[model samples]
Every structure is written in C-alpha cells, then in structure tokens.
Target: MSAFGKDGVTGLYETHLPVARLERAIDFYENRLGLERAYTNDERRVAFFWVGGKQSGMLGLWETGTAPLGMRLHFAFHASEEWLLDGCSRLRDAGISPLGFHGEAVEEPVVIGWVPAMMLYFKDPDGHSLEALHVLPQPPDRAFGIRSLTAWRQYAS
Candidate 1:
C-alpha cells in the first residue's frame, strides 16, 4: 500500500509578488511578459494577471515597500521548452537580459542535473526573481547527485 494519502492538495492555485508600484508591475507582466490583465485596482494597489488560465494560473502583484537589501523571493512557472525559448527570444529582442540561475545574461538554458529540469530565469522591474522551467519527462535514477549548471556541463564535455 502507498504511504501517500489524498490531502486535497494537488497543484498550485495562485501566487503573489510584492512590488513598489502597481501600474509599473502591471505593465511589466502584461506588456513585457504578455500576460493577460485579468483584474486591477488602483485603490487597493493591486493587479492580477492570468498566467495561463482564469482560475488556476493566476499571478497577483501588490504594492509594498521594497525588500531589505540582499533579500529576494523566487518563483517559477512550468513552461514547455518551446514556450521558454520563445519567451527568452522575445525578451532579448526587446533588449531585456535573459537570465539563468546566477541572474546573469543567459547564453543557454541552465540544466538542473538533479531534477534534470531545463530552466531560464529573469527579474521583474521590482527585482523579483522569476523562472520558467521544463521538467524532463523521465524516471529518476537510484544513484543520484546534484550538480550546478557549470558542473553539469562537464558530463557533456
């Protein structure tokens, strides 16, 4: 018998990001990332964007003070490889830097060796770290170890 039980928890419902300004954040998510502006409230200083769907894939941006220096929050969206690549190209074409794990300009997608997920990362106008990842469809190996992006490249060398 499996140890796992039905916890009524299956997948992500929604996520929120704090920003210093609402309108700029809304523009970034909408114009920059092409997310649909589902809702907005200037009084509440909040904007909600539909990432993929109206119900589940919702991302909210709320106006708040900036985080303390060196403090950052990170989140990721599950994307197909094609979608991620297209997004990278789009952002880069708009003169935005496509970032990887180190938050630097990405020459290529960073491959997470453990989960074997291919991912790309970037920052919002508020400096919020965001990522797009594609988890490879493959079973895990029993003998496993984690490797950094640079280190993982050694295997292919």
Candidate 2:
C-alpha cells in the first residue's frame, strides 16, 4: 500500500559532518581510517570520501570553522566482526581511543543487545562520534542489555 513499493530502504548511502579543519579531517578519515577519497571542493570547503566502495557509501566533510558551542553527531559504518575486534589496537596506534558503548575506554567491542550487534566507538578529529558495527548472528535479546562481548558470551552460555 506504499507508493514506493515494498522495497523500502536499503542502507545509508551518505553522511555529512562539519569540521573545524578540512585538511586535518581529511587526514583522519583518509590516512588514518583508510577511506578512499572520492572528491573534494576547496572553494566550497567540503570533501567526500568513499566508505566501503565507490558505490557503497560516502562521507562528506565540511569545513565550517570552530563553532562556539560545537554540535556533535554520531554515525556508524558497517564492519566485519574481525575488523571491529582488531580495531581497538589499530585505533590506539593512531592516537585514538577505542571506546565502549558507555563512552569508556575499552579493549574490545561491546554488544548492543537490542540490536544484537558488536560495535567499536571512537571520535573523529572534530569530536564526531564514529562507530564500526557488525550485527551478530543471533536473535535479538532486549533483556540482555548492553555489555561487553565477554559478558555476552558468559550470559549466553
């Protein structure tokens, strides 16, 4: 009964964030995170990076100078369990702290029971919360709540 049919939406294609410095943001996303740069506009003070692939998803960074109060936004990128698990060390090597769901420094990804997904959180150069997430191969258990992977395994057993 929808005009767009039953297909609905597939996934996020693009996301934009405001940054205080374009070059610094570019270094964090492109050099540190390993995202491929798709395009950049020096005049418009914006840049775009390919997330997974050229056709998969894109992230746009706009240099808006430093805001007085600063508005922070959060977004997640689809990742494999292996990447999420190993990202803690990789992030630390890059001088970034891998964080848990509660915003605490962590050594491993945390499980969001409602979504039943493992996620690793960190901040970009501009303080925008970024996450690498991978859905678990299990049924959702809302009562389980958010916990570390170790706790989740123990609870499941």
Candidate 3:
C-alpha cells in the first residue's frame, strides 16, 4: 500500500529565497510584510517565516552576500481581494510602492487578463519580486485559455 495520500502527490512544502543581509530581510518580511518569523540560525545565516500562519505555509530566506546585484525572483501567496488592497496600503505606509503585474508602480492589484486571478506585485528589500494573489470564481458560461496579465478580468465575458 502507498504510504502517502490516495493521490499520486501532495501540495508544495516550502519555498526559499536568497537575500544579502539577514537582519534587514527579516525586518522587511516580519515587520513590513507581516510574516511571522518562525526560526533563525546564525551559523547558516538563514531564517524561516510562517507565510500564512504557523504551519500553514513556509518561506525561507538565506543570506548570500556574493550573488550578483539586481538578482530577481518571484513568489506568490494566496490572498483575498480585500487583503490585496490592504497589503498594498501597508506597503505604501511603509514607504514602499506596490507594482502592477508588468512591474510598473501601481496603487492597486492588477486583474490578470488571462487567468482567473488578481495580483499585486512588489519587491522585498533584497529586490525579489513578490505577488499577493486572489483566485476568482470561474465563469459558468464557458472555459477560457491562458491569456495576458492585462485585462484578465474580462476573459470570461
């Protein structure tokens, strides 16, 4: 018999990102973005945060000082539209700007034209791009295919 679930596989376990400084990155994620720091190790210079709450999701930040400047990465967390708006405000209140899907600074989350989701993109202090996402209900009329991020709200229409 299978030791795991009835299905073949399971969900994602965790995600990791690299940063330049451990302390600053901690502040950016814990204080600025509201993630709870779950663990840290100085010898490894790594920190882990509970993304949605304790044991719900995991994010790891590893300090690597020798990487090239302007290194970029992307990560997304599931959120509601209300949370997305409030999150944008939180970033603004911290003097950080929110970004549209195309990477342009914006005041609100963009409704991706192709997918059934809304997204707000921004970067952490280490320049790793992040997204706050809200998946929408599928239209009852018909199905759609992958499309561009812009005007995603109208895909089902």
Candidate 4:
C-alpha cells in the first residue's frame, strides 16, 4: 500500500522551534523539563538541548522576539505510560495545564485509536503545542477513533 521501502528512515532526531526569549525558553526546557544543555549560541540567539540522551536527539530554540500569529507548532516527546498517566497532576504542579486534543483542560491523557497511543497535551512558553505520548502494545484500530483512556479500555475489552 505504500511506495516507500522499510529502509527509508529510522526516527526523528531533532526539531527546531522559534521562541520569544532564549533564556526563558532555556530555563523552561533545562530547569523545568530537565533537558541537558548541549550548546548555546549567544551571537545567533539560539540554544540546543539534548533530549533522551547526549547525541541521541536534540531540540533547538531560536530567539525570534515574538512568535507570529498562527505560527504555533506541535511536537511530542516519548514517555512511559506511567508518566503519561500521572501527567495531569505533574503538569499542574509545574504550572502547566494538561490539555485534551481539543485544547481543553483535562485530568488524564487520551487514547488516539488510530495510533493507539496514550497522549497528553500542553503548551510551551512560546505557545507551541507539546505532547507526552506512549504507544500502546495493541495493534492500531482506525475505527476506534479517539477517546478518553477509560473509554478506550472499555472498547478494547
């Protein structure tokens, strides 16, 4: 059904985002999220952080004064199911509101049946959408659609 072969690519290694302030972004990512600082270019007003592990994956933040209207981007970070399940309280404690797919505040993660993954959403200081996700062990079920994790278990059972 697909034209591409299996050897096309492995996985995502890096992503870049525009930020209003480099220091603030660095603080949120480094001090808050605990990502290791890989490098920072003061001249270019850019910073890089190592995600997961050193030299494995990276996130880059570029200082752009202000994020343009409707320029919000989204990215997800791989997380454990346990971490994602407790995301709501953890995020709330960190002053971040956990959100559902529609951007409404929620107490738990949702299961996207297409991907069959449990995911929680939030926004960064720059208004860029962020997610913490963990793939389920079951096979994908497009017909199942998206729903709360509780509903997903009911349907699956």
Candidate 5:
C-alpha cells in the first residue's frame, strides 16, 4: 500500500488565505460560486466553506490590512480535467489571461513530480496562483494523452 493506504486517498484539507474583506470573499465563494457554508468563527475572524464536495476551510480575513502586492501564496483544490479546463475558460471569459508555467495556455494537463499528481494551475481574483489537480496520474494504460514532465520537455526539444 502506498502512503495513502490501500485506496491511496489520504485526508485532504484546506488552509485559509488572508483577505482584506471577509464579506466580499465570502460572497465570491459562497454566493457566486455557490459553495455551501460549513462553519464560521466570527470573533476569531474565520469562515469555512465546502466547494465541489470538499471542505474548503477557514478563509481568514484581516479587516484592516491590505493584501501585499504579488501574493505568490495560493490555495488549490482537486478537480477533474474538464473542471480545470473550464476554470481556464472562466478566467478567459472574465478577461483574465492566465499563462502556464511557460507563459502559455496549459495546452495539456501535466503531472508535477513534487506533488505526484496531474495538475493545471492558474491565479485567483487576487493574483494568487492556484492549482486544480488529481492526486495521481490517470493509469498509464489508459489513453488520456497525458505526458510526464521529462517526456514533454524531451519531445519539445
């Protein structure tokens, strides 16, 4: 059995991203995206939500401070390839041009060695880089037209 036990799906959790306006961010995730509210700690300044069947926990909002410029840290969620592509499409429709690692559209999905998963990354409304990934590659025997990092680099070269 791999690290995640027999089925290999371990516990996946979420981390809070600091925001300036709690209400606005909550509105974005809760109303616009229709995520279900899981819980909130008003005095402690935290709110949790469930998006796409996953518990997207506490999004911390620092009411007074402004977010730093170029906030590189981001939060990610697991999604299907279709959802990933659709997210890209949504960004495009919203007039946000997302560039892949190589500054191009993610022409195809890829598995990052660091995370050992197939992923596509993009930014959120705050320019925070976010990723939607599968925990593992589609079985090698399956024909998803996917490629490993080395393979794509070598093929391009």
Candidate 6:
C-alpha cells in the first residue's frame, strides 16, 4: 500500500542551512528579514524561524564547527518586487550588497529580450548564496521538455 495520492509529492515542511554562527543568522532572519524565531536547540546547534505567521514551514540554521566560505550553495525565495527592494535595503543597511539584479526591473520591464521579473542575490553570514525574486509579467505558453536528449533518455529508459 502506498500513501501517495493526487497531490503527487509532499513539500518540505522545513528547510535547514548550516552556518558558523547561529546567533548572527538568527538576527539576520528574525530582525532584518522580519521572521520570528520559533525554536532553538543549543545542544544541537540549531535554530528555527517561522515566516509570514506560518508555524509548519520553517527555516533552520545549524551552527557548524567548520564550513566553507563564499557561497557553499545558492537558493532563492519568491517575493514581490517591493519586498525584494525592502529586503535589499535592509541588507544594504547591514553592509551587504546584492550580487546583481535580473529580470524586468533592469530598465526593461517586458520585451523580446528579457522576462518580467527581478532578482536580487546576496550572501548570508557564512557566505551562503541567497536570492529573492518577483515575477512581473506572466510567462509565455510552452510545452516542457528535458534540456537535453540524454536527460530524456535517462528518465524514459
């Protein structure tokens, strides 16, 4: 018997990122980003936050003894352009600048050249790459396909 149903696959209730300092990450997520710290497990060197008042979904930070610098990994979250600007302002106030901006707000809202959206990338305290993005115009219609023939074969075969 399988529990899987029409929903296909379940999404993660929480996501965790390892860092060097829990306190700093907590301050960034809670104070700057306006998220609420829900729980902290000092023994495990873990801290959690709840965003937008949702308790089930959480962002977790893990204090590690040794971690690489300069963006060990990159991830993104969706937000409005206003939120992106506000977040960017807060990060700038804290002495951090985004990597670059992408999408429509780059002097081209919508055209044959670029899509309608904006992306702001930055690094966390431990140098993990993060981005906040907003979609302006809706995407064009298209049939989805694997990027390469090898990918299609790997999935089909």
lDDT of 2 by residue, 17-40 (tens): 989899999999998998999999
RMSD to native, candidate 6: 9.4
Per-candidate Cα lDDT values, in order, are 0.74, 0.91, 0.77, 0.89, 0.56, 0.60
Give candidate 3 regions above 4 Å deviation: 1-10, 67-70, 140-157
Q: Candidate 4 lDDT, tens digit per residue, 82-154?
A: 9998999988888889999989888889999998999999988989999999999988999988889998999
What local lDDT score does residue 64 receive in model 2, on the 0 to 100 scale? Answer: 88
How well does model 2 score by local distance difference test?
0.91
TM per prediction: 0.79, 0.93, 0.79, 0.90, 0.57, 0.64
lDDT of 6 by residue, 19-51 (tens): 877889888877766678888998999998875
Query: Where does model 1 exceed 4 Å of error?
Result: 1-7, 65-71, 141-157
Name the top TM-score candidate. Answer: 2
TM-score of 5: 0.57
Worst 10 residues of 4 by lDDT: 63-72
Residue pairs clashing in model 4 are none
Best-matching candidate per lDDT:
2
Any idea what lDDT model 5 has? 0.56
RMSD of 2: 1.5
Per-model C-alpha RMSD: 4.0, 1.5, 3.9, 2.3, 6.1, 9.4
Candidate no. 3 TM-score: 0.79
Clash pairs for candidate 3: 112-152, 113-149, 113-151, 113-152
* Model 4 stretches astray by more than 4 angstroms: 1-4, 65-70
lDDT for position 81 in model 5? 60
From the highest lDDT down, the ranking of the candidates is: 2, 4, 3, 1, 6, 5
